[model samples]
Target: MPIYNKLVRDRIPEVIEKTGKKFHATVLSQDVYIEELKKKSFEELEEYIAAETGAEALEELADMFEILHAFAAVHGSTIQGVEKIRKEKEQKRGGFNERIFLVDVED
Candidate 1:
């Protein structure tokens, strides 16, 4: 009966029940949900950074991707809308594909 007071995916309870494990979970209020999602995003990012193998990294990245979608919805936008903004920024300022590292500029 370990305690895990954190946000989880919607199907987690069902998955736990199939294992005959009883757990208690509460629904977060709108404000709290947003806050928790932010926390979860950081958690996922840390896991992604710690991943050693390519497959493990991709798995962590997928988790972060899910969090990104949740964030977009919480902010009243869809993933498509986010992608559109990203493309516009890319067109204006370009993306990281060039791997350019900027040094200090002269004053």
Candidate 2:
């Protein structure tokens, strides 16, 4: 009977029930959901950072991408819209393909 006070995938409750273990769960409000999504995004990012292999990192990266899509949808936008915005930023500021690391700035 472990207590989990964090958010989980939508099917998690159903999976838990299949094991004949009683669980307490409730739907979150839109505001709460967004807040939790933000936290979940960071959790996933940390997981990606701690991943030991390329495949593991890619899996965590996919989780982060899913969270991003959900975040955009919650904010009354779509993943396509978010991609458009990202592209615009990349066009203006340039992408990280250069792998440039800034060390210092002098006046």
- Top TM-score hit: 1
Runs off by more than 4 Å, candidate 1: none
**Cα lDDT tens digits for candidate 1, 14-103:** 999999988899999999999999999999999999999999999999999999999999999999999999999999999999999999
Scored against the true structure, residue 7 in model 2 reaches a CA lDDT of: 83
Clashing pairs in 2: none
Candidate 1 Cα deviation (angstroms), residue 52: 0.8
Best by lDDT: 1
TM-score of 2: 0.94
